[model samples]
Target: MTSETQERRPLFKPVRGVTLAGLIGALAFACGVALTATSGWLIVRASERPVVLTLLTAIVAVRAFGIGRPVFRYVERLVSHNAALADLTDRRTAAYRQLVPLTPARLGTKRRADLLSGVVRDLDDEVDIQVRVVVPLITTVGAALVAVVTTFVVHPPAGFVVLGSVVAAALVGWIDLALERRGQAASLAARGQVDRVAHLVASGANELGAIRATDEPMTWLAYAQKNVEKAAFAQSRGRAVGVALALAVTGVATLAMAWVLDGEVEAGTINGPFAALLLLTPLALGDVVGLIPDALGSLARSSAARDRLEALLTQEPAVRDSGSEAAPNETVPHLRVRDLTASWTGEKTDLGPVTLDVAPGEHIAVTGPNGCGKSTLLAVLARHLDPTGGTYAWGERDVRDLPLDAVRDGIAFVDDDPHLFAGSLRANLLLARPDADDTDVLRALERAGLGPWLAELGEGLDTHLGEYLVSAGRSGAESVATATERSISGGERARLGIARALLSERPVILLDEPVAHLDGPTADAVVRDLLTASAGRTVVMVSHHPIAFDALDRVIDLPAVTS
Candidate 1:
């Protein structure tokens, strides 16, 4: 939750040298093509066989240069490709960091799966535009133009034809812009639908199976299938248009080039050899021109992706800190919330201008019915969300002005649903403190009551506990069920959550229903451990458990907020 080091561009560094290399490679390629063409013309027109060797030597030199240019091309690609990949990596990191601060406000607005798709798939696809479509197109087309001009010095008609074809291709692209936009829109819609269904299927696979057991699996599956079909239809339509336009242009160019060559040859202005070379130029140039519309459509899709990324980059983190404020370790913060109000801005307000204060070393309980906003209160207190009204101050300073990292480092939160990452238990525990060694890991595991789970795995601390079992002896479902049924029940997960929070050594801890999933004995033990763990720190917890009421220093209840 800490703010990453503030740096100039997070992921995308512009490498000017790559652009230079691409240009050089493209130029060399075009030169090689023109040289080979000129050498053929020389062999055909030479008055003596003695001159044929010179033309043959020119052909060999051109082929050698052509072979070597791919190496330069590879280097150019490597630079741009790595730069793009690195930029995407940084953009993703920044987006995640931004979400950490905005998550409280997002509560029900943003879907994690959708945002994840945008970060991983969409961002990657968009980078393909810059690295693949844009850079390559520019370099090749620019080089083609140079080659055409050089050819014009030899034959004005051929040069004119090349220039005219390029212009026609540009015009074709401009005229088809509207259709391209429509295609892009379709592609975007298809992606969004896919993301929605993917999230639904992933989160509900087990539940859907349960429904299937009731002889109603077809109902949901039928609906999901219909959605998939619709998305596929849209995507297919988009791509079909791109392919259709590309083929249409190629057809038109082929016919037009043949007609042009026929007239030039019949008029005796250019011989069969010259006409042969002229025809070959279009065969190559036709492909180059045909790619224009597809590239534009690609550009459209990539632009949308860029906008998504830029939206994240350009966003102001809900809590912004320049690191000039006091660090977490340097300050003992006594948080006070006076008439603090928060609402889910779009919907009717949920929780309100409730008042509360917690001095250093104080433990407070927030108890309320399901919709009463106990969780919302804790979120606002942790600086996850800004209050609609009133003020939150830490040791007489406005909490908003405090550095975001400072707020995050000072407070540790354990939500109702704890996340277990796909890694070893040791790795999951160390997420809060990556540098934690074996002793610290063992102590944390012991506190969380995960010792038994570790012992069962036999690999102890090194065994993987991801959703999928790493070894044949252990299956994912079996491991989860085993851990839940015996070693770490909901109560145990709660205890583990508390243990993780405790390991953070944060000054303020916010836990939502920490003992809700626990059995009576475990719950009681955890409540005692919670108090002991937060002995000298501020602890604010939300729980409807009556047992929590008797053990706390103070309790506050928030009534549902109204407009």
Candidate 2:
């Protein structure tokens, strides 16, 4: 578990603001029930030819209740939404912080895009409960109780009927919740599988076609889609049954109330106008319950989302964030290791059971055949994963005793696939160093062999990239077209990644097959520029390509087994 979640807040923690919103919601629902009852009485009494002045009060009451319903409802919505959004902001921040430490290694096989999407979507569902579930459920129950007591006062038997109907509806709601809970879990699981398969097939279409391997992923995608459809249909069927039962209970209760009222009138114990008012009250309350199938489903969905979040947030991170203090501040600190061993999973070692040392400003390459742990060694050096056995140090300071981010901040680790966003050149480069100016950006680009590319651009730093939304002004937005569609190639993208690393201005650079995707000539050029741009910095390049070893750097090759 992360430090952010150590003092975790409950999904619906007790708060005065939420309580106030609930009370407002209840009041609004009561106003709706009262309006229907009064209007019924007014109409019935008018038909009976009462004294005109006596009718004046009933006419005025109907007007007040009618206006109050909408007005109170608006206030209720305002209060509930305000409180919910405030809590949502806080919860989103906390949940994201908890997720950061467990990323990559602990996140399984999912891409960062998939992980981020799930987190954002789940958090939204969890927060929506305050407005969608709690407000409506509380409002319906509170207003129904008020109707029950008022009916019992006017006609005792009718009151008992109202209470029984309400109890039955509440039971239906409970059953619906239980069924929906199961249905929602299944639907989410199925939908997640479908998305995963669809993404895999869509993203790897070219590779699959090239290798004639499309059949299996395509078949799996179809199966996952069918499962989603089945899950969705089952969930909808359960909801339909629940709604039908709740409405049936209301219909039965309305008839029982009528039967009792008819007998009361035959005995001359109650009047027609009074009976109309009492009958209308239950129908109005029943309408509230009738409107709640959507709310019930939302409650179930939110519960499922909360469970997913809890599962993720409570997971222990793969690496320990140790020490009360960060690493002592240093640029180009000497790196040393003694019999290091590490693993992606806890059960087996994937890298090391080896040793290495590097002086400040030394350039070194870790090269090996496939399965020799070249990438795994870089993971340990970048502080992404910790050594499971033996020791590593930075300038005599044991790295295990240093905070992860503090040690990581001193190194610029660039991987094979460097993500570029859809924005202007300036906006994209600004990500590496937010405070960097246009000159710093240009210099970085020039250093990474992008000077000629920049000069070729008509707009230079203002050149827009792939599709994205750009703010037009304070009031609106516009879409930017794809700039990379015109002249950008794979080599340019690789060089851009190198430029970003140079812009980071860290004392050490770690490259993990940065040119793995480029062609022979392009890869050689990129490696040359990289070695030139990182002349002074301590550089470690992990590659099996001989072109990567062109410069003055000792190559350390790892055998299949290190002892």
Candidate 3:
């Protein structure tokens, strides 16, 4: 097991479908196979007319036994597949929601793509073990036990042989497990490399053009290719070990069957049906034993993935929720911070021992030099990051005492680099309020100066965008068009983000350089419109331009905040 796997939270309950299917499958298999074995005994004792009737009865029972085999297989597949997908969905949603409270600024030194990959892909892969490995393992072992016990009751020597072969096969399987575990660790490392390489390739695509002018693209490709090789090498080694173990077990079973037949013949106790039973017994045991190593390999990976995902799900956010609610009046203070201090890591303080207050209808501009913790201050006030020390209150209640939903509903924030999901202009705008009507969406879009841009596009509000465009690539020209259609100019993207914030219409709005890419005149117009739009709300903004601060009710200079 991986070190991270130990961190996984235990599943609250076994998956219902997998558990139920496993139970039914194990019982059905035991009964069906045991009855078939009994038929073998009857065929050996009976002859002529009795033998023919007995054979026919056994064939009918066997046919019934196999009747729902496909159905059973389908049930197993459906149960296992859904469990992984459901768990992945839960983890992805939780991770993104956790990110809402932490904020991008609070991520400190972590890479965005690496974290994204872990939360999205990594967690999903991990939870699959619950259905795939755990349930199947339980059923297989249970079925094996039933088979062994039945054999023992019929013939003690056959039972002894089966038990001994099982023990020997298990020992070989354990050895395979040891080899597979090492391979699994290597596999995980290889996957991490792949993730990192993909991230670099994405972020450095433009830079890669310049680098390729100096023939450096090959170097980057080589590094990525090497990671792929490492992954393949590890996987091959694991599968090879499993295959070797299976072959060895099958060889041992074959030898045991040969010995059994020789001994029965010498004792003159061999009957046609009895001989057939001996031959079938060893082969059936071998088939079951062979499945062990393959299942073990999958289990190891799934176990590792499950543990990592669980750890993330169980983690408490660094920020605490506040039970405060927004009251409409401008007289009551909407937010107040007293000597609040915070740090991404506890060892080094990033902001304050500073005090601030903003009442409803107040507009505050926070100005500072780069890296002076201006954004961090706004994040804390917005309750995206909790104060490590001191108290922050909204209205009369402490911020931490406020309900998380209440705090979020009362506040809307627009970052300089706003994330736009893959969708049409109307679809993206409506994300702020899914049920918003066309009028509501167009109003927000026009306010952010996006209506003209949307209208200019032939597809208008229905234009498809984002990573999904890759699917529409039918030719080189189509691929180029797809990329261009989805691509947003920096200024346009900024306005799109602001449009979303405007649609929210929260009591408190926190904007981090909303006019980041606009020229002098356009920047002034945006600030003026923003101030006008936020007439009866609390606004906190980080800005450097003096003109941007004109309508602010308060200006908090970061130089005044001390560690």
Candidate 4:
């Protein structure tokens, strides 16, 4: 989509509940103004020694207005909150769906946790604008109009004073919004830095301490916090100016109304009791206008957030599905790539114009230096990324011509950092093959060299794996912080990942440095067991350690990029 189209899109589409809430809010504020003005009129008339029966109407009206204000406000709060929450749910779901296709390629180089945090925070800021800015602004304007018109019908000069005061308050709100917009971008950038630093510190504390790099990350955290404080102080100054302007205008308008009423009373244009009502009208209305500055600040923040969300959602996916929907052969499929080149960004090539071929049921190992394109090749083969040049074929048919889902269904790709979800071992393994029973799961685990580890587990397949550890003796384990301490060893984790792939039962399996963190002996043993378990399936393994495989059919070595 074009930038112009995104700019024209509305952030908050009006909901029915918000509309109802807005009407209720306006009525509530109007009641507050009426309560204050009627009470003033009633008190002035009472002091003049009027009969109690003659004052009954004003007395009853004052009581009704006083009681109605809180009631309407309570209903307004419930309606607006429900509407905002419903809007938040829909928006979050849409944003997540848009992000799925982008995945690792377009999300940038930031840590996954930091990217997710920013998305969540931005979504909250966008949704909050409805309650904070839109509904309240509607209510304030509606109440102000009622105040101006009512006072005008009673006394023209008092009406003009109230109108001028409201205009001045609006001017202050606009100026505050402008000032907030200037600082909001900087504040958002600082907030992103803080999130990145905080996520790194929280998730990698052990690694940093082990490498004696803890002080460096701490220094970065301090720097980000300083920027956040500075930005907040600047934004706060704008809000303060808005509050002072509102107060000053309100005071001026109140005194001006009193002066006009004094002249009108002497000229017999308005009675003494009626003059009291005009004098207090502006004071009551000023309270509603006082909320304008903060509402505008929220408007500025949410506007920024909306723009960010639009930009992210409009990004084109790295790989597009082909027009053709042909399916590959269901049986074990052969794989071939001739002069294949891939790029994370289309502007430059990151992976080579390299070539390889594998017959069905063959085992091949790919090894290269750090900057080589082993993992990039695997991404292209798995259809998670697009190839910039040449061709990749499955079962002698160009993979691009096949249905995207059909091509991906034939292969299982496991990387070094496989995520273990917060669930039981059975749940984790079942994700690979949902139809697989406990017997199938145990067989896959045993084949992947996890039989010994499974035997040691007190609950076997029922052992809870992540966040909260559960065993036979421990029935109340809820400490997520220590879950990692109870996790399996490096080799066991690698084998579990392999077991997941084995259980997939796909025609082709691609392994990307799955044992990179294990010791030399463990790495060799894991690779040996992985090959044994993946027998008769077409397998491709990428490793930096390059363990010798007795049953390996072929080896492909990638050359490093020179320039």
Instruction: Quantify all predictions' global Cα lDDT against the true fold.
Output: 0.66, 0.81, 0.68, 0.84
Can you tell me which runs of candidate 3 are displaced by over 4 Å? 1-13, 27-54, 75-117, 120-123, 197-221, 322-338, 355-364, 390-398, 457-462, 465-486, 515-532, 543-557, 560-563
Q: lDDT by residue for model 4 over 215-312, one digit each (tens)?
A: 98899999999999998888888888888888888888899888888977999988988999989998998889888988888899899988887777
Worst 10 residues of 4 by lDDT: 1-10
- Cα lDDT of model 1 by residue, 1-563, tens digit: 33344443422233444456457546545655555555455556553454566667656765665576566567667766776677667656766765665565543444555466556776677766756566656666776787578658867766776676666667666655556566556556655655565666666778878766524444555666676677557655665665565566556655665677798789998786676566566455554565566667676667677666666544444444545666544355788888777765635556676777788988888887788788778877877766677888888777777687677778889976576656766777777777878887777666655566556654466565543334323565576454432233576567667767877777888888877766777777777767865788888888888655677889877676656
Model 4 clashing-pair count = 0
Q: What local lDDT score does residue 162 receive in model 2, on the 0 to 100 scale? A: 91
Q: Please, what's the RMSD in Å of model 1?
A: 5.4
Which wins on lDDT, candidate 1 or candidate 3?
Answer: 3
Per-prediction count of colliding residue pairs?
3, 0, 10, 0
Best-matching candidate per TM-score: 2
lDDT of 1: 0.66
**lDDT: the better of candidates 3 and 4:** 4
lDDT of 2 by residue, 158-228 (tens): 88999998888888888888888888988999998998888889988999999999889989998999999
Model 2: what TM-score? 0.92
Please report how far candidate 2 places residue 494 from its true position, in Å: 2.5
User: What local lDDT score does residue 489 receive in model 3, on the 0 to 100 scale?
Assistant: 68
Give the number of the best model, judged by lDDT.
Answer: 4
lDDT of 1 at 481: 51
Better of 1 and 4 by lDDT: 4
Q: Candidate 3, 313: how far from true, in Å? A: 3.1
